[model samples]
Target: MLRIGVLVSGGGTNLQAIIDAISNGKITNAEIVTVVGSRPGIYALERAKLNNIPSIVISRKAFNSLEEHDTAVCEHMKYCDVDLIVMAGYLSIVGDKLINEFNNKIINIHPSLIPSFCGPGFYGLKVHEAALERGVKITGATVHIVNEVCDGGPILLQKAVEVKPGDTPEVLQKRVMEEAEWEILPKAIDLIANGKI
Candidate 1:
């Protein structure tokens, strides 16, 4: 089985989707072995606990530097024997140590279609807000390999969601999550876990 370590910062809707997908057999040959929260008291950690998965909290603020924080994360993943690292709404910008250690084993689910409203400073609701502001008719999600660059990795999967009239950023964000992020993230995981990628 492919051992996965999920990294999260806030509400873990994407993480929940992965758990559900695995539970329902939509994703075979993989299991979530560990969950690491960037901060304590996040709902993602609670989800991991409820699911009986091992979890840890490693806050960047507590570390002396970004490299130190990423080193701690990498060590924890190595300890867990994780084959893959999934960034599910993880807000922290990982440094080179973790990226180099994990290499192509890391994947991230971006809320937007990427290359449009993604990159540094584009995350969470801000992405949706930017999309709406740009008045794009189509907005979606992208699952891609995590590299040294932010959201600049090779794309694995993308699903487009239509931008409807009278849609606010919040509404579009929910739609994109439901229609795109939730669907493609698990599919990407399955693809990677099965060695189809």
Candidate 2:
């Protein structure tokens, strides 16, 4: 079985989806070995606990530099013997140390269909707000490899959700997560674990 490690921040709704998918046998040939949160007291940690998965909190504020924080996180992953890394709403930017070590073994879930509202400065509700401001009728999610260049990694999967006429940023964010992000993130992990990607 592929030993997986999840990096998360905030509510970890995607992490919850992944745990549910694995339990339901939708995500095969892998098991979550650990859940690492950038900060403590986040719902992602709680989700990991509820599922009986091992978890740790590596405080971003504790380190004086981003590189230090990423090195510590990568150390934990190595100790856990994780074969794959998944970023399921992990907001912190990992440094080159982790990127070079994991290479194409890491994957991230972005809130929008790539090349649209993705890359530096586009995240959370801001991405949805941009799509709304631009009046894009279709907005969705993308799963991509975690290269050193932020969201510039090659795409693995994408599913579009139509933006309704009266949609607000919050509403669109919810719809996209439900219709796209939650579905594809786990599928992408399964694909990697099963050698489909």
Candidate 3:
């Protein structure tokens, strides 16, 4: 089976989606071998433990320099023999070292449609807030190859979630995340695992 690693920084809802996909046989020919987090208290890591998967905590504050931190994450991926690195709510910006090492093997899920409300200073609730403020008729999630720049990689898959009337940022966000992520992220992973990418 193709071994994969996941990096998470928050609640791991995306991680859970992947797990559900795997359990439901949506992603064939692969399994998530390891999971790493920047902090200890995250539910993502806890979920990994419950599944008996190997997990690690690499703190951004532990390293004296950014390069060191990147190196540490890269080393962990290498140690796990990770064939692919999935970024699910992972907050830290990966350095060029790790990006270069993984190349197109690393993938990320962004909350908003790229080339729109993306790049630095945009994540999670921030993306939803910006989408609501801009009055975008449609907004959703994107799964793409990870590169040195934030959300700058080539798009592998995208699904648009329509903006409904009287939608608060929170409500719109929940709807979009549910509609887009469960479909797109698994499809991207399956494509890569099947050598279709």
Candidate 4:
């Protein structure tokens, strides 16, 4: 089985999607071995608890340095014996230790189609706000390998969502999550787990 370790920061709606997919057998040959939150008491941790999955918080603020935090995160994943690491809305910027340890084994679901409204300073509702500000009718989500460069990894999957008229950032964010992120993230995980990618 492909053992997965999920990393999250906020509400974990993407984490929920992965959980649902696994439970429904949409993602075969894979199991969520653990869930790591960037901070304590996030809703993502609650979701992990509800699913009875092993979880822990490794808040960067608690560590003296970024390297220390990254090492802690890496150590936990290694302890879990995770075959894959999924960044499902994890907001923290990972350091070289974790990136080098996991390498291409790490994957992330970005809020945008990427190469646009992505990279540094683009996340959460910020991506949608930028899309609206630019008046882009086509905005979407991307599932990509996690690399040292933020969101610069090879794209595994992308699904476009229409940006409707008078759409607020929150509305577009919800639509993108429902139509693209929810669909492609799980599909990408299945592909990786099955060695199809």
Per-model TM-score on C-alpha atoms = 0.99, 0.98, 0.97, 0.99
What are the per-model C-alpha RMSD values against the true structure? 0.6, 0.7, 0.9, 0.6
In model 1, where do residues sit more than 4 Å from their true spots? none
Clashes of each: 0, 0, 0, 0
lDDT of 4 by residue, 59-123 (tens): 99999999999999999999999999999999998889988999899999998888889899999
lDDT per residue (tens digit) for residues 80-156 in model 2: 99999999999999889998998888999998989999889898999999999999999999999989897999999
Distance from true location, Cα of 138 in model 2, Å: 0.3
In terms of lDDT, the poorest run of 10 residues in model 3 is: 181-190
lDDT of each: 0.94, 0.93, 0.90, 0.94
Ranking of models by lDDT: 4, 1, 2, 3
After superposition, which runs of candidate 4 have C-alpha atoms over 4 Å from their true positions? none
Model 4, CA-based lDDT: 0.94
Let me know the TM-score candidate 3 reaches against the reference structure. Answer: 0.97
Tens-digit per-residue lDDT, 133-170, candidate 1 = 99999999999999988899999999999999999999
After the best TM-score superposition of candidate 4, give how far the Cα of residue 8 lies from its true spot, in angstroms: 0.5
Candidate 1 matches the true fold with a TM-score of: 0.99
Tens-digit per-residue lDDT, 27-145, candidate 3: 98889999999888999998898878889999999999999999999999998899999998899889998999999889999988898899999998899999989999999899989
lDDT of 4 at 177: 98
Which ranges of candidate 2 are over 4 A from the true structure? Answer: none
Superior candidate under lDDT, 1 versus 3: 1
